[model samples]
Target: MSHHIVEVKDLHYTYPDGTAALGGVGFRITHGESVALIGANGAGKSTLLLHLNGCLIPEAGTVRMGDFPLTKKTLPHVRQTVGMVFQDPDDQLFMPTVYDDVAFGPLNLGLPPDEIEDRVMEALATVGAAHLRNRPPYRLSGGEKRAVAIASVLSMGPSILIMDEPSSNLDPKARRQLIHLLKSFEHTMIIATHDLDMVLDVCGRTMILKGGHIAADGPTEEILQNEPLLHACSLEKPLRLQGCPVCNPVRA
Candidate 1:
C-alpha cells in the first residue's frame, strides 16, 4: 500500500474579507507521486496550497503532513517538509543574490555555514543555474529567476513540493525546460496549473477544483479527455493531445 505524505480532510478556508476559498476540500498525496491540481481562476488552487504549508490556517477541518496535523505546534515541521513555489518567481525570490536566495531556507533552519553553502551549490547545479549564483535576482530573466526560485525550495531538502502555475509566463522553450527539470525530481509534487499540456506531460494523477470544491479526481488522461466535465468546470480541454493514443492512454 502507498503511504501518503499529505492527507487533507474536510479542509476549509476563507479570506479576511469573508470570501470562501476552499469548501471542505479533501485529498491525499502519496509519496513520490507527481499530481496535478487543475482548476479555473478563483477555484482556490493557490488558497489550498497556502493551507498545506500553514501560510493560511483553515477556519475548519484539518491538514496533515505525515502524522502531524497542521497546527501552531506542528507548523514549523510541516513547512520544512512541504516546500511551496508560488506562481510568480519574483515574489518568491527576494534576496540580493541567487546564492543567498537558495541558502535562505537552510540558513533559517540553522544549518552550519559550510553545509548551507554546499546545499546552495548543489541546488543551483540541479536547476542548471550554478553559474548564476553570484548574480542578483533583479537582473535575471524570467526563466532564470524561476529556476533560481526552484533551487531555493530544493535546498531545504523537502519531501513534498507544491507549485502554483509554474509555467504561467514562460515561453515554449522555458516551459519545456521547467517541465523536464520537475520530472527529474523524486519528491512528491502537487502542481496547480491551467496548462493541460503540462499536466499531461508531468503528472500521472489529476484533480479538478470547481467553485472551491473537488469536482473530479483520477488519472490525468481520463480527466483531461472528459470534455463535458472540463467544460462544466470552465476549463479548456487540450487540443493537440486529445485523442492521441500514445499521449492519452487509458487509466490503469
Candidate 2:
C-alpha cells in the first residue's frame, strides 16, 4: 500500500488567449517514485506541472497534494509542499545571491534565523553548491545555477519535487551531474523532459501527454519501446535504444 503524495483528477486549464493547455489530465504519484512526463511541444506538459503546485488553477477538475486541495486558501501550503524547479534555472534563481535564493522559502515559513541558516547551508551542501553561497546568481555557470535552483527547492524540505525540462541547457558533464543529483533525492519527483535517456536513467514510470490528454502511461521500458505511441507523440526512442539491436529489432 503505497501512499500517494500527489494526486490530480480531471484537471482542465485554458489560457487567457484561448489555448487549451490541460484537458482533463489526471495522474497520481506515490511516495518516493520518480515519474517522467513526456510529450511534444504544445502537449500541455508545462501547464500540467503548474497545476501540481497550484500555479495555474484549472477551469475544471481538481488537484490535491495529499489531502490538501489546491484552492486559493491552500495554495501557499501546496506550493510549499510541492517544490517546483522551472525549465530555466534563471527563472528560479532571481535573488541577489545564492544564499538568499536558497533561504527564500525557509524565510517565508518564518523559521528562526538559525534554522534558516542551517537549512540553507544543508541544501547548498546537498547540491554541492555551498561554495557559491555568496556569489550572485548572474555570476554562476549554467550548471552551478541549476544546482542552486535545486537547492532552493530542497531548502524548503518539500516531500515532492516537480521539474520542467531540468536537463534542457546543460553540457554532457553537467547533464550527467544533474542526473546523479536527482537520483540521490528520496522525495517523489516528476520530471517533464524530452530527454528519453534521462527518463530511462532516473525514472521508473513514464507518462505521455498528447494534446492536453494522457495518451499512455506505464513502465518506462514498455512505453518507450512502443514505436507507435512515440510516433504519435512526436518522440523518438532513446539514443541507447535506437542503436541497440535488442531494443530496436525492427529497423526499417
The number of the candidate with the highest lDDT is 2
lDDT of 2 at 170: 92
- Tens-place lDDT digits, model 1, residues 20-134: 8899999888888899999989999999989989988888999888667889999888888888998899899999999999999999999999999999999999999999999
Each candidate: what lDDT? Answer: 0.90, 0.91
* Residue pairs in clash, model 1: none
Task: List runs of model 1 lying over 4 Å from the truth.
Answer: 1-4, 242-252
Work out the TM-score per prediction: 0.93, 0.95
Task: Flag clash pairs in model 2.
Answer: none
Look at candidate 2 and tell me the lDDT of residue 22.
Answer: 86
Cα lDDT of model 1 overall?
Answer: 0.90
- State model 2's lDDT: 0.91
